[model samples]
Target: MMSNSTGLLLHNAKDDDDEQSPFEEVAANISNKDDPTILCLTFRSVFIGILLTCFDSVVFQFFAYRTSPLDINIGLIILLAYMMGEFMSKVLPEKIFNITINPGAFSIKEHALITIMATSGTTTTFAIKAITVQRIYYNYPVTHVNGILFILVMHLLAFSIAGILKRYLVWPASMIWPKTLMSCCLMRILNIENQTETTETRWTMSRSKFFWLVVLFQFLWYWFPGYIFPLLSMFSFICMIAPHNIVFSQITGANGLGLGVLQFD
Candidate 1:
């Protein structure tokens, strides 16, 4: 009985040790995958900043000429700023900004500055394109000076309104910018992967086929209208006659902005 009891005790101790070993390994693996917190905050700030810029572009769409200032947009400029901020922060001397300032890192203020600069470039481009479109396409009679004034005023308006409102709209506690949050998470994962030895192989289909398919559809839509539609219209006209049909007149007048003809004849 004593020998059996000793054997059972040894077997239970071995199982306990085996169980504890895996938990420790998992904990270490998690620690290895840790990402810098700054990555999340920076990414979110940039994303929201761009979102505001895009909103400005959208507002321009409702105005004459479908113009944005500088032909610059939120998507392109904000992305450029984020990339440049990261690069510049890495390249500039650590003490350039301040004696205590660190290289390759920034406070919220610095990040906002980068975002604003990038947005300025985008807005400027939008304004230029808008003015060109108005001059060339819409035949806007406004002189060069007035156009410049309009562009400047519109830009200032958008920037001031967006800047003032961004804080209240973007940074509420428990508020979720879902797209921005996803972006933040993706950036964090990417950063963590940078420290790992593992290489991830991505699987994707060639987009050429999809691109061609879309091209083919668009070609058909336009081609059918340009060629077949005119032919069909010609055939309909050939089969038609001007009988002064009351029903036809009624239908035609129904499509117009006034009531159908009322005749006592």
Candidate 2:
């Protein structure tokens, strides 16, 4: 009877495993969850998130004008947020006696949420250019209130359009974007405060250390293209040879209207 019962228990466990969906299993095993004390979204989240959004938007916009447009990587942003969030949590006062600004210690989830919010806000809306055109080209200034309203209306319309398309575009398993999956993994890794130590791995550097090293390399490298070696951005042969010819300058110059661009460093 005990043998039969053990066999039944094993069968039930197998059944349970079989019943679980692959996605469910993955979510259960791989999802990032830790101490529940840190709140994910708060007024602070909105504040910092919006600020990050604005900063990233401005930086990217400035670079967009360059001959070699540089993308402000979201991963770098996330890393920055992680470091900042961690620092702020340790330094900032949790609460000032009764009156509190920060209710509890900062959490990784908070950092992730802020990063995500800033990322979403980084994409400047189409309405912004429309407003810009009116303000600059036509010299018709849109009032601050009108600008806010325009943004609100545009976002609402976009959200509605997204909802309408989600059923057909997003529901299918095959439609899931690989980059999005990678983003999810990245977020999880970034937010996870404590990682399991592996003895098998021979690499000595921590991920955070590696990230900083890469950042330092990129930071130093950017100066070449951005300032020191301007030719690195666009080494136009025509610009070099026909530096005086207006027609050739127009055809190959990065600053002027050009027929084509050639970039090498």
Best by lDDT: 2
lDDT of each: 0.48, 0.70
Measured by C-alpha RMSD in angstroms, how accurate is candidate 2? Answer: 8.3
**Model 2, residue 66: C-alpha shift (Å):** 9.3
Q: Which segments of model 1 are wrong by more than 4 Å?
A: 1-91, 94-116, 119-130, 163-168, 186-265
| Candidate 1 residue lDDT tens string, 183-215 | 343233322333322344342323334434665
Cα lDDT for residue 254, model 1? 29
Go through the candidates in order and give the clash count of each: 16, 0
lDDT of 2 by residue, 1-265 (tens): 5798899999975654444324653453344334566688764566678878888888776775479866777776776676767666667676666645565656667877888777875556788778989999999999999998998899899999999998677643334455656665566555653344578666766654565587699888888888898877776766778789888888789887755666543
Clash count, predicted structure 1: 16
